[model samples]
Target chain A: MQEKELIPYLYRTEFRKITAVLCRLFGIEHITIAEDIVGDTFLLAAETWGLKGIPANPAAWLYVVAKNKARDFLKRNTIFNEKVSPEVQYSAGESHEIEVDLSPTNINDSQLQMMFAICYPGIPPESQIGLSLRILCSFSIDEIADAFLTNKETINKRLYRAKEKLKQDKVKIEMPSGSEISDRIETVLTTLYLLFNEGYYSASRNTVLTKDLCLEAMRLTHMLTENKNTDKPEVNALLALMCFHASRFEARIDKNGELILYEDQDISLWNKELIKQGECYLNRAAKGDLISRYHLEAAIAYWHTAERDSPEKWEKVLSLYNRLLMVEYSPIAALNRTYALAKVYGNKAAIIEAEKLGLDHSHLYHILLGELYATVDTQKAIRHFTAASKLTKTSADRNVIRKKIDKLKK
Target chain B: MKEFVMVYRSELMGEIKLTAEGNMVVSKEWENWMGGIAAQNKLVSPGMRLGNEGRVIKPGNVVTNGPYAEIKEIIGGLSIFKADSIEEATEWAKTCPILNAGGNVEIRDIIQVNG
Candidate 1:
C-alpha cells in the first residue's frame, strides 16, 4: 500500500504497546534490543508493504514479523530461550498462542507500568523524561534535547544514567500491585502532563511539539480508559481536560509563534472534534461521586470553549480556579485566578486582592496588574510594566511589554 | 551510590554583557543553564550558594582576600548527581557548562557514615 495510506495504521501508539509487552515478557536488560527489533519490523514493513500492498491486517503482519525478530534475538541472547516458533505464531486472524491482550484493558495497564518505570522516583527527572520519550514515544535523544532546549550530550548522559539506575535497582517490568499502582499512576500521569507543558510553553521556533505532547497524553489516557482495572474517573477526567485545552491550540498562536492572550484569540478556530471528545470524556468522568482537579479544570475549559460570547463565563472560570486552588495551592493558578478576577471586577478591587497575596514576586502577576492599570493609572502601570520587563528573561515577552509601556505614554 | 559535585566556576564577578535595551545577556544565559539543571531535578537539598563574602578556611586561621589563586579556580556553584560508580559519575560531570567556561569539575566521593 502507499506509505500515505499506511500512515494512519502505523503509529507510535502500536509501537509503544508492542514494545512494552515484549520488554515485559523478556526482561529490562533486553529493553534496548527489544526496541531495536520493533524498529526493524517497521523498517521491513516500509520496504515490502509498498510492493505487496498493505495486507488486509497490517498490525498482525507487523506483529508476526516483530515476534519472529524477538525470538531470533532471544535465541542469540541465551538469557531468554525463544518461546514462539515463527510458523505457529501467525495462524489466520484468531490465535490462542498470543495470550497478550492488545485491548484497552491490557494495553493501558502495560503502558502505565512502562511509564511509571521510566519515571521511577530513583531516576533523575531529566532521565525520566528523556527515557520516557525515547522508549515510549520513539523520540531520538537529539529530538528530546531540542524539545527541552538542551544539547544532545546532556540527554544522552541522562538516558544512560536512568537506564543504569533501573538496572541497579533491579526494577521489574510488571506493574506494581494495589496501592503502589495508584501512586505509580499518579506519577505517570504527572510525567505526561509535564511533557505536555514543555511542548506547550516551549520557547522553540515551532509550536507543533506542544500539540504532539497533547496527542501523546490523549493516547496514553485512552490506554488507561480502555483497561478495566485502570479506567478510574480521574484518568478520564485528565483526558477530558487535555482535550478541552488542546482544542484551542490553533487559536493560541499565530503563524509567527507569538503569544495570543486567550481573550484575543479567534474562537472559530477551535477544533469541534476535540471539543466533542472532551464533552464525552467529561460526562464519563462525572459518573463517579468524587470530583477531581481535572474534572473541575475540564469543566472550566469546556465553559470557555462552549460559549465564546458569554462574559459570565469568566466568573465560572474564576470559581473553577478557586476550587482548584483548594485542591492544590499552586502560585501559578492563584496568579491566573487573580487576573480573571481583574477582568470581571474593576482593577482596584482586583489589585487589592492581588496585593494581599505573595504573588508580587512573580513577573507575570506584575504584568497582569500593569495591564489592569493601563487605563486608570498610567504611571503605576508604567512602573509595574518596567518592573515586569526587568523580571522577565524572554526577549519576546519583554518586547511586548515595552511596546505596551510605550503606547501608554501616548 | 556515589555523589559527585560538579562545581560551575566563573571569572567575571559582576561583569555582565548588557544589550542596547539594558538587558543582561550573560546573566540570562546563566539563569537559563541553572533552570535547565534544576528542571532535571539534579539539585540536592540543603544546597547553599556562596556570594562575594565567601572565604577559604584553613586549619589555623581564615583568609579574607588577597591575590587568590586564578579566578577560574574559584568555586561558584555545585550540582550533585548520584551514580553507581566514580567513572559513571565522572561521565555526568563532563556535561557541565563549567568546563566550557575554563573551569574543571573536581570529582571527590562524598564521605558518609553508615552508623
Candidate 2:
C-alpha cells in the first residue's frame, strides 16, 4: 500500500494501542502527556518516512520511537523521573533503557484497563464518552464537538473537566475485580451504547450518519468480549444490538444523505453478514439468567433486521419494547416503544399512548405525532410537523420534517 | 532543470495540537504529495521540519530568541524539487499537502552558484 494510505490505517489500528501502553507506563494521571508523546511519534514517522520511505517493519519502528520518546521524557522531566521512573525500575530493572511492556497480552490488558479508566463512575456519562472518544478512539476535540452537535470550546472544557476528575479521584488504570466489575461494566457498556447511538442517529447537519463512531463503539465492545472477565451476557447483547443497527447503516441514508425511515428503507441494502453476527451474539446472550436492558434492546434490534412487512416482526418488536421500558424506564425508550406500538397496533392507539407520555418538548414526539396523524387528521399532522421542524436544531432534520408537512398539506 | 524550495507556513505548526488520527490524515496527504514528486524523480530534498525553539545570531555575534515573538505564521518545514522553470515549480508547490491544514507554501528558486 502507498505510505499515505498505510499511515492512516496504522493510525486507526496502532494509535490506541500505543496510547494505551504509554498510559499504563506513565499512569492515567499523565494521559495527556502520553497522548502527546504518541502523537509526536506518528508525526516523526510521517516526516522520516516521507524522506527515507517506509521502514521494513513500520509497527516496530513506531514502538522504537515511542520507547525513545518515553526515555527522553523520563530523562528530561524531573517530576516525571521522580514519579514514574521509580515505578518503572521497580517493575522491570535499573537498566538505563526504559523497558515498556508492549507485548500482545499487555497491549490487550492495557486497553481493557484504559476502558475501565475512561468509564470510571466518577465522571458523568457524557464526559465518559468524551474521554473515550478523545483518548481511546483518538477523535479530535473538533470531531467530538461535531458528534455532540456542540462547539469545540464546549468539548474542550468537557474533556478538561473529565480528565481533571480522573486525576482528582486518582482513578487507577486497572480492571475492576469480582463484584465491582459488574457495576463498572454497566458504565462502560452505557458509554459504548451512547457512542453508537450518536453515530447511528447522528444530529450533525453536515453528516447525517457518523459511521466511524458506530464502528469505534463496536470495536471497543468487541475488546470486552475478548477478555474472559468482561465477556458478560450484557456485553454480548450490546454487541448484538450494535451489529444489528450497523447492518442497517447502508439502508439508513439515501444517495442525498437524507434519513430513511425503517419502513421506507430498501431491505436489499442491509448487510447479511452483520445481521448473522448479531444473531450469533443474541443467541450467546440468552445463556445468562439476568435479562438486562441490552438483552431486550438486542432482541428489539434483531426484529428490525427481519424481512420487511412482516406482522410477526412488528409484534416481536413491540413486545421487546414493552419489556425494555419495564426493565429500564427511559423517556427516549418509551418514545421509541410508541413507534413500535404504532407498527403492531394502530396509529390511533399509538397516538393516545404517545400523547399520554407528555413528551411535547421532544422533536421526536412531535415527528411521531405528525406521522400518526398523517392519514387521519392532515391539519393536525401539519401542525405537529411544523412544531417538530421548529424544535429540531439541524437543517437536515428540519428539511425532513418540512417535507412531511408538505406531504400532509397535499 | 532548476531546483526550488517549498516552505510550509502555518500557525498550527507552532503548537501541534492535532490528535493522532488527525495527524495521520495530514501526514498521509503529505506522503502522497511527496511520493508523487518522488515518482517523477524530481525530488531534490524531502526537507526538515523546523523546531519551535530556536535562537538567532546577529552580525555583532549577539544571539537572541529567533523567528520573532509576535509572528502569526511559523515556517513549518521545507522541501526541494527540480522543475523546468519557476512556473513548473509553482505548479508543484500548489499541490503541497500543507495547504490542507490552512497553511501556504512559499516557493523560492535555489540559485546554483558553482554549477
Candidate 3:
C-alpha cells in the first residue's frame, strides 16, 4: 500500500486490535475511554508522522505510541487510579510500569473475547451488530450508518443507548463459560453471519457492496475458528458459508456496476482460492454430528460455485434449502428455495410456491415471480417485472428488471 | 537560511464532527504539508499544538481564562521552517492543512543575536 493508503488500512486492522487489548486491560465497562484513547493515539500518530515523515516501522510505532498514550490516560484518569488501577497493578504484579500487552497471542485472545462481549445476549441483536461493527470492526459511526443504509443520527442514538446499557450492566469482556458456550457461540456466529450479509446484500439504492465489510466479517469469523475456546463446528460452517458467498463477489456485479443475475454470471470469475478455503472449512464443519443453518447454507452456496450446472447440483441445492428452512424458517431463505424449486420441478411449481409468499414489498419476490412466469405467461411476467422495477431501490436491480421486461416484450 | 515560525490559527468553532476515517484524511493532509517541508530539509522544529484551554495571568497576578476561552480565533499549532525570506516562508504556509480548515498562518522571523 502507498503511504496515503497505509494509515487507514492500519486504522482498520490495528484500531480494533488495540481497542480490544485496551478494553480488556482497562475493563470493558470503560470501553468508551479505551476507544477515546485509541482515537487520540491515531490523531497523535497523524501529527507526529506528518512532522517526522513515515516511521521506519509504522505498526511498531503505533503500538509504542498507544502504550504511552494509554499510560498517560491511566495516570490522568483519577477514577481509574482510585478503582481500576489497583486491580490492574495486582494483575501486573511487581511491574511498576503497567504493561500494555500488545503481543499477538494476547491481541487475538482479547479480540475473540470482545467478539463474545459485543455479541452478548444482553445487547439487542441490532445493537450487537452495531457494537460489533463499531468496536470489533473499527468502523466509524458514519460507516455503520452507510452499512445499514440508515442516517447517522439514528445509528448514533442506537449505539449510545447500547453502550450506556453495557456500562450499566458491567458486561465483562470474556468468553461465556461452561454450559453457556454453545448458546454464546451461536449468538456470535449469527452476528457474524448478519454482518457479512450487510456487506453482501447492499441492495439498497446508490451503494455497491464493499469488499472490506465482507473481508472484515470473514476475518472475525476466521478468528473464532482459530481459537480453541470458541471454535465450534458451527463457527467453521459460518466461515465456510461466508467463503462460498465471497468467492462469487466479483462475478455478482458487472463491469458497469449493475447486478448480474446468478444465471448470467461468468463461472470463471469465481475465486478458486476462496472456494477451496470454503471446502476446507465445510469439511471441518462436517466433523460434528450437528448441522447448523450455516452448514446447510454453506452446502447450498458450495453447490452454486460448481463450474457446470448439473441436475445433481440443483437436486442437492434443493434438498439443502429444504433442510435449511426446516432449521431456520426465514422468509428470505424460503424465497431463495423457490428458485431451487423452479430448477427441479419446473417454473409453474416455483411460481405457485413463490406467489404464496405474498412478499409484495420486496423487489426480489416480484423479480422471482417475473422470472418464473417468463416462459409460461408473458403478460403476467411483464406485470411482475414492472412491479419489481418500481419497488426496487438500486438502479442495478432496476436495470436488470427493466432488461427482463424488455426481453419479454421482444 | 533565516528561520521562521509559522503560527497557525483557526476559529474557536464547535467541534468538527468527523468519523475516524475522516479525521485520517485531514491527518494525511497535514502529513503531506509536513512531509513537503521535511523533504526540502527546511523544517526546524515540528512545534506543538496548543491545548484548547489554558490559564492566563496578568501582571497584577489577576488570573483569568485562557485567550482561547474568549478569543474567536485561537492559535492551533506552530511549525518552524528555514527559508531565505518571509515571502519564501509564506509560500510554504500557503498549502498548510490548517488553512484548508479555515485557519490562517502568521509567519514570524526568528532572529539570532549572539551567533
Best by lDDT: 2
Q: Candidate 3 overall Cα lDDT vs. reference?
A: 0.81
Residue-wise lDDT of candidate 3 within A165-236, one digit each (tens)? 887888887778968899888888888888888788875433343566789899999988887876789889
- TM-score per candidate, chains pooled: 0.67, 0.75, 0.75
**Candidate 1: tens digits of C-alpha lDDT, residues A27-126:** 6666677678888888888879778777888888887788778666654665543433333345412543344445655555566678767878887666
Candidate 1 chain A has its poorest 10 consecutive residues by lDDT at: A84-93
Model 3 TM-score (2 dp): 0.75
Clashing pairs in 2: none
Compute DockQ for each candidate against the true complex. 0.01, 0.00, 0.00
Chain A superposition TM-score per model: 0.83, 0.94, 0.94
After superposing candidate 3 on the true structure, give the runs of residues whose Cα lies further than 4 Å from its correct spot: A81-87, A91-95, A204-209, B1-115
Clashing pairs in 3: none
lDDT of 2 by residue, A171-243 (tens): 8998899789999998999999999988888876545338899999999999999889999999999999999
Please give, as one word, the docking class of candidate 2.
Answer: incorrect
Can you tell me which runs of candidate 2 are displaced by over 4 Å?
A78-82, A85-87, A205-209, B1-115
